[model samples]
Target: MLDIKQIREATDFVRERLASRGGGEESLVDEVLELDERRRRLLAEVEALKAERNRVSKEIGRLLAEGKREEAEARKRETRSLGDRIAELDRQVGEVEAAREALMLRMPNLPHESVPVGRSAEENVVVRVFGEPARHAFGPKTHVELCERLGLVDFARAAKVSGSGFALYTGRGARLERALIQFMLDLHTREHGYTEVWPPLMVGPACLEGVGQFPKFKDQYYGVAEGDDPSNLGRLYLIPTAETVVANLHREEILREGDLPIRYCAYTPCFRGEAGAAGVGTRGLIRMHQFDKVELIQVVRPEDGYEAHEAMVRHAERVLQLLGLHYRVVLLCTGDLGFASAKTYDLEVWAPGQGTYLEVSSVSNCEEFQARRMRLRYKDCQGVNRHPHVLNGSGTALARLYVALVETYQQADGSVLIPEAVRPYFGEERITP
Candidate 1:
């Protein structure tokens, strides 16, 4: 939520920003300001009325003590009417304040001044490209084709069990997925200074709200089935991302100043409904109902979050770089960015068989958006408490990373060369039947 006072003070600045985000009424800003003014004025009026009532009550007390019944009676009657008026105004003030807050929450965070002004992902500027897309002398096999031929992935059985878009990674395929998870967790925890934390795979609605996912993306997430209830309305849902849980670890609590920058990493199987998605793009592990991912989350001082966000992007990119996969870094445009993120950097890996760049990671700097909702704060040296900035990035998404690995490294003989970083865990260089 925005500070109403700042919204009032920076109306023009806010207007320009809302315009850049696309169509929205500029009057919405005016509305917030107008309601804010009314709310503040009513508050002051109520305070004044309360003060008058207090003064009158004291005067009445004095009158009664002196046995001046008539004066005391008059003062008491006057305050009775004032009390009724205060109650009426108080009701109005509450209603107006509630409306103002609803509007404030609907408002998007103002884009950073340095952010590029663009409409869609097509307009996103590539900051850098790393490694070259590998080439196959013969027709390259897609991960699905390669996985099927090698008896590695079992989509036919997965479909019978769950439906399309889900795959059963058997033997080496499963081991490869586990290996990648271990590799990422090890790198992030040992070398990159992140603490390993295993958070709940199932979390409540409040946790989703902390990451600004509930109200906007309720459709995209999977809610837990309510037992014996006709409507599947329940208190909890399968977590869509570790971000939902890890970011809210300190929700509603104040952290010690010494723990200013907290880093946490977790491996969890994420579940998503993907309600309206379809077609070739949504096939295989690229989009799934359930997939495993190693998530990296950080809570940092406001001054350090942007730098931390950059480091997070590099960390995600390093995973692909180590795997010898070509990828590019994209700075998301306003439309392409997530709801809570003020800025987002996406890592798209080259999928040779698919002949496209598949987004394998998104590192976002949410600033204080999630913190405000979670009430996660830290006290500074001056004894001032403020929301700590939060950031989360996929250390790597194992499923899609597996897609890139299978497709890019597949040989004409139908074997996959495991990356050196994951080989120690997988126990071999070649995944052959």
Candidate 2:
């Protein structure tokens, strides 16, 4: 959540910043200012009424002490009327404040000044590229074809068991998925200095709101049915990513200065409604309603946020480097930034079989945007409590990464060669169907 004080103090500045990101609202700032002004005015009126009521009460006491019963009764009646008016003004103040909060919650975080100015993914700037994409003498088969030939994934059965946008891994395919999960988890926890966590797959509305996924993106999530359990009653959604759970670990918390930078990695089966994402990358593992992901989250001091963000991108890139996959990093432009991210970098891996690069991870610097919503704060050395900056990235999403691996390592004989880094986990260097 944005600081309302900042918006109120520098309305024009906020307006211009939002406009640069193609988020121009002609009267958004004006509405906020008007609501705030009304709230303040109502509060002042209530205070004045309370003061007058108190004064009248004192006068009533004086009249009663002097044995002037009728005068005291009149003053008492005036105090009651004053109290009623104050209650009405207080109600108006509450309404105005609620409206302001709703608008603030809907507003996207302002892009950092350093973010590139662009209107779409096409305008994203490529910052770096890794090893060259592998070439094959024979035409490389797509992951779907390879999976079918190898008896690895059964899309037909998956559709029968669940529906389309799902995959049923059989034999070596299941093994590969498990190996990749363990390999990525080990890489993040052992080598990348992240604490591993296994969080609940379901979270409540406040958890989603803390991560900026509720209210706006509610339709993109799967909600749990309300049953007899009272605790589970309200809005509950399956986690879209482990980031939603891990980033909220410190929600409503105040950490010490020594705990400035906290890193956590979690692997979870993510569920997305994919409400409007019907035909885009629907084939194979590129897009799915249920997919596995290893997510990375960092909470750092404000001064260290940008640095942590860069380090996080490097951390995600390292996984691809170890796997020997050709990938490139693209800095997301202002218009492409996520709702809660001030800046972001997407890591796209080359899918030779698919003839295009697919996004495998997105590292973002949310700064204090999420922290403010979560009320995640830390006490500085001077004992001043301030919102900490939050960052989240895919150590790499598994489905597409799995597709890239399968296509990149397929042999002419239809066997898949495992990457050296994950060889031990797979217990074999090559997977021969």
Candidate 3:
């Protein structure tokens, strides 16, 4: 959410941002300003009427005490009228405020100045590329092919159980997933200063609203009904990101000044309904309805969010660097950025089998957009309450990273060489069936 004062004063700045997004450019700003104006005016009017009613009620009490019965009755009648008017205006104010908030929630975050101006990922500039994609002397195998031959994954059975875009890991595949989770958690908690947390996979609508996922990605989530009524189902949704839970842990609470920067990391299986996508490219574990991810979230002072964002990106890079994976970092163009992210950096890993780079993680700085919606705040040294800046990034996505690992480390004998980092977990240097 943007500061109301900033929206009013920086209307042109916000307008430019919406324009760059390529659609819905002209109407949103004007509609928001109009609704806000009406809300403020109604509130002022209602406050004045309440004040008048209070004054008259007291006068009526004094009049009755002085034995002025007729005057007191007249005052009572006037107070009753004021009460009715106040009630009507109160309802109007509520409606206007609700309308204003609806508009505000849909407004996208302002892009950072450094973000490239473009319409799609094709326009995104690669800031840096690491080691080259591993070369194969023979025909390279895709993740699906490698997993099937190695008895690591069962897709046909998974589809029978839960439809497409789901995978059933077997044998070493299950162990590999667990090993990756442990590897990432250990790295972040021990070396990165992030506290490990286990958060709920199912969350309430209010929590989604805080993270800017409710309105934007509603269709993509799996909503669960909350109410007991047969007709009026109370709905809940599976989390699409652990940040939705981590960022809202301190919602509506005021943290002490000493805890200026709170960092958290969690391993959770994210669920997303890739509704419209189907067929070839999404083959294998690349586009799954369920996938495990280790997420990193930080709550910091507003002034330090940008610096913190860069540091978080480095933490993500550290994971790839340690695993000996070849990848590249790209700055997401403004038009290609997520709705809530003012700026984003995507890390793409080279997949030899696919013959292309696949995105493995995205790190973003949301500034105060998420904190404002979550009502997350902290008390500064001066005893001032203010919203803390929030940032979240995928330290690494398990499934996509596996695509890079299997293809890059494949040997002539069909054995997979486990990275030195993961060797301790498997109790062997290579995965052989």
Candidate 4:
């Protein structure tokens, strides 16, 4: 959430920065300001009414003490009228405050100054490329073809059980998925200084709101209906990403300056509604209703936010580097950035069989945007409370990486060679039909 005070003080500057997004986000500045002004005016009126009510009450007491019962009754009647008016003003204040908050919640974070100005993914700038896509004399098979030939995934059965945009892994495919999850968890926890956490798959509305996922992208998530079970009767949503859970781990918390930077990684089966994306990249594992992901989250001092963001991007890149997958880092343009992120870097891995690069991860620095929403703060050395910056990135989404691995390591005989990094977890890794 943006600080309304900042918006009020620097309206033009805020609007200019948000204009780069080009979605009329700049126009929200005026709406928010108008609502805020109305709220303040209502609050001021309520305060004045309350002050008058207090003065009348004191006069009523004085009149009664002096045995002026009639005078006291008249003052009491006036006080009752003032009280009613104050109650009406208080209601108006509440309504205006709620409207202001709703508008603020819908507003996207302002892009960082360094973010490139562009209108779409086409304008995203590639920062670096790693390893060339593997070449083969024989044409590479798509993950779907390879998995089907090797009896690894059963898309047909998955469709029958859960409809399309879902996969049922069989035999080595299931084992490979498990191996990847363990490998990522171990890598992040052991080598990257991240604390591993296992969080709930379902969260309530406040949890989603705290992470800036509610009110704006609500349609993109699966919501759990209220059930007879007492514990489950509320507005619950299946987590779209582990970031939603891990980011709220410290919600409404105040930390010491020494603990300025807290890093956590979690593995979860993400669920997305994917509403309105019918037929776009729905084939294979590129897009799915249910997918596995390992997410990395960091809460750091404001000064260290950009540094932590860069480190997180490298941490995600390291997963690809260790697996020998060809990938590139892209700096997202303002228009292409996520709602909660001030800046983002997308890691796109080359898919030989698909003949394209698919996004495997997005690392973002949300600065204090999420922290403000979650009320996550830290006490500085001088004991002043301040909002900390929050950052999250996928160590990698398992489905796309699975696609890259299968296509990159497939042999002409239709067998798949597993990468050395995960061989120990897979036991004997050259999966053959």
Q: Backbone collision count in every prediction?
A: 0, 0, 6, 0
lDDT of 2 by residue, 82-192 (tens): 988988988888899999988878877888989998888889999999999999999999999999988989988888888878889999889989999999899999988
Candidate 1: lDDT over CA atoms? Answer: 0.86
* TM-score of decoy 3: 0.96
Worst 10 residues of 3 by lDDT: 226-235
Each model's C-alpha lDDT? 0.86, 0.90, 0.88, 0.92
TM-score of each: 0.94, 0.96, 0.96, 0.96
Residue pairs clashing, model 3: 224-236, 225-234, 225-235, 226-234, 226-235, 227-234
Off by over 4 Å in 1: 23-27, 230-232, 278-282
Candidate number achieving the greatest lDDT relative to the actual structure? 4
Better of 1 and 3 by lDDT: 3
Q: Please give, for residues 19-108, the per-residue lDDT of candidate 1 as tens digits.
A: 676647355898898899999999999999999999999999999999999999999999999999999999999999899876766676
RMSD of 1: 2.0
| Regions of model 3 farther than 4 Å from truth | 225-234, 278-282
- How would you encode candidate 3's per-residue C-alpha lDDT over 229-269 as one tens digit per residue? 64433256788889888889999898986897999999999
lDDT of 3 at 385: 94
Off by over 4 Å in 4: 226-234, 278-282
